[model samples]
Target: MSDQATLEVRNLQTHFFTKAGVVKAVDDVSFSVGKGKILGLVGESGSGKTVTGFSILGLVDEPGRVVGGEILYRGENLVGASQERMRQLRGNNIAMIFQDPMMTLNPVLRIDTQMIEAIKAHQKVSDDEARQRCRDALGQVGIPAPEERLKSYPHQFSGGMRQRVAIAIALLNKPELIVADEPTTALDVTIQGQILYEVQKLCAETGTAMIWITHDLSVVAGLADEVAVMYAGRVVESGEVDGVLDAPQHPYTAGLIGSVPSRNARGKRLQQIPGMTPSLLNLPVGCAFKTRCSYSTPVCEAAPVLSEVAGGRQVRCHHPLATEAV
Candidate 1:
């Protein structure tokens, strides 16, 4: 990983205005990804991980907007950038891989057609040149017989293969940063592992920073260099993956790690965090995890700002769990 950060998100607040009330989809979330490094944005559904990715890409549509903060891509603020500028940057300087492969692939189009279009959209290349680039990208993602796969349609491939195609598209431009939102969630474990390895290798070779958004800690443990845990639209804890996973200081982080099946003994029942995630529109005051956290106290009633608890580690909790206990 390079010393300079490729992307820096500072106090990002993306909100949705509905008839019922305002939904704080991403509130004061902050993190950074260095060149060739991966930051896993882990959180359950509705925790704003996906929203954050969308905000960075300028993809949030009607009724929702980035209300505050800066999304600095190589020192340039993209929050106030023009639509034309964002369009130019989207598939060129930055790319996003959504959870569903169909979101990226057109059912009626051949894989080669889509991939070539993606390349030509940013660069003026000849058809043959674009096709070669497309073939090379497919090969990079471990697709078998790239030449043959390029001629196939979306439906001709399995779920995992389709995802590999989507990933290949994302890598076509060799963007400086990629925000992958659970792209491997539906794949079998073996395929997911293969994809992870390929992605990590790509980042290292190309110096492309990545934000891998998922709820799976095991994936993050193996793939991400840094981890950020989100709750109720805010980052609750963040640090180097090893330190955060082995010695989680935040109660929510601890709960998440404990709930992982491998963390339990051979025959013991898996542990679970009690209570449910609060609704964004009607979230409780202060710490959102307090209701479910065993260490909550009166001080937790007041919102806790992210504070550095140790070197390169931060947690948003009045009474953070002890590292040893975790």
Candidate 2:
């Protein structure tokens, strides 16, 4: 990993102030992404992974706001940056690829119009040049007949095609950072593989840092160099891919690995992490996973800090699995 990382998030706390209660979506989360590296944010739904992404991109709206955090982009603080500055930074220096392609593309406009507009929005380029760049980007993502596709509207393309366009739009800027939130969930295995390959190539060629948020360990196993597993609005463990996947330290991490069908022990039923994640608004005392952790101990009554173990891995638990003890 590079010593000078592209992005660093320290003590992030995002909360939504609702009439019911204050929902702590992302509670004191911290991680970093190095240049040209893909960091996988793996967690179940409502684990605050997507919220953390939005928080980094400054997309969280009122009612839900990033209350405390230091979002450092290449040593600059993004948390205190002005809205205008952020607007200029987003989609130009740092881009985000949302799960839904339609969210970024307007159905009323043709592909060329939308793509060209995005290019011209940040650069002093002519419409023709922008159009050419758009075509190149489309081709980069393995979109066939890019020239023809540029003339078509959103409704004219398939689900996978639209996602390709979205991915293309994200790559158009050759951004320094990209946060992709499960952009391939709807795609079939083959198409997903193609997209993943394209994304990897884009990052390798441009040295772009990426945070790929997904619930699929298989996806991370193939694409990410580092992995962070989150539960109950906090990262339970994070480290190099092989270390975390092969010998997970935290029980939550172990349970997640066990739940994967392909990882099940031969002739044995698949293991699952019992109980759902607790409500953020009404979290239990001590370690959030204590209730569900089979290895829980009296020390779990107090919240555990993320302790650095071997291989630079970090695990937040009073008593980690003996198999991975440092």
Candidate 3:
């Protein structure tokens, strides 16, 4: 609600009910993103990063629901808003760029059709005005010959170009908040760099807030203003990007930083966090990460609450290492 933050998600719990059991995809996850800034949400696959984003947008479907917690946009709870209101908010006040461009682009429809529809769906505008805006959006994301490309179908564009078009649609609205789930993953490294630059420029120019979800630490280190690390569906550490990455408090966080290619110590085999992420359906009773933690002890066997550590950083580890602690 304060002027500093654009979106604040607190203790968000999203669960999926299935025949196997209840899967706590997102459990007690909390973080805040300030205006005109990028908050990187990083974790291994199936760590609930994507679901958290979907939950914030109210995109979670049947058998899966946001069971508890508050998603505050400008300090207002969006948890129980009606579908109509939510629809109005989406693509207008807020937007999302999915990992797969096909999620946003209709395969059978021409690019122009989808772009114009996205624009006019939330505003009253003539075809000419909408078309102009659509063209501009496409050009903004660096699509070549955007006017001609607009007449083409999704299948006609290369994977990277399609992703750029999808990003353009998200930027067209100049949305105040955007949740981008691995938006650059499909693009080539060169294209990915360009998109990152475009995203940063868009956020700076529009004062838009963003939560960019990715598992690549290098991506976060490059583009994000702040970083939040998630494990077992919960945030284990969060802080200013430099502070958390340079000197991580939690063992898990240190491991993540170590696993990055740049930080690979010479002659020391590349460090990696051993063991797969725990299954949400059958999460361990103790600290979910205690099983793999090098510094874990009897105290770590109990659940650790995300408490404020030094420098406004929040960490959830009972036996966090002081050597790396903020």
Q: Pick the candidate with the highest lDDT.
A: 1
Model 3 lDDT tens row, 104-223: 688889999989988888999999999889899889988888889999999998888889898888877779999999998877899899899989998999899999999989999999
Check candidate 3 and list the clashing pairs.
Answer: none
Ranking by TM-score: 1, 3, 2
Per-residue lDDT of candidate 1, residues 285-310 (tens digit): 98888889899989989999999988
Shift in Å, residue 62, candidate 3: 1.7
In model 3, the runs with Cα more than 4 Å from the true position are 1-4, 263-268, 323-326
lDDT of 3: 0.88
User: Which of candidates 1 and 2 is the stronger one according to TM-score?
Assistant: 1
Model 2 residue 120 CA deviation in Å = 1.5
Residue pairs in collision within model 1? none
69-186: candidate 2 lDDT, tens digit per residue: 7999988888868998888889888988988765657889999988887788799998888989999999988889999999999999888899999988888888999999999987
Q: What is residue 104's positional error in candidate 2, in angstroms?
A: 4.0
Sort order, lDDT high to low: 1, 2, 3
Q: In candidate 2, which residue pairs clash?
A: none
TM-score of 3: 0.96
lDDT at position 284, candidate 3: 82
Off by over 4 Å in 1: none
Best-fitting candidate, scored by TM-score: 1
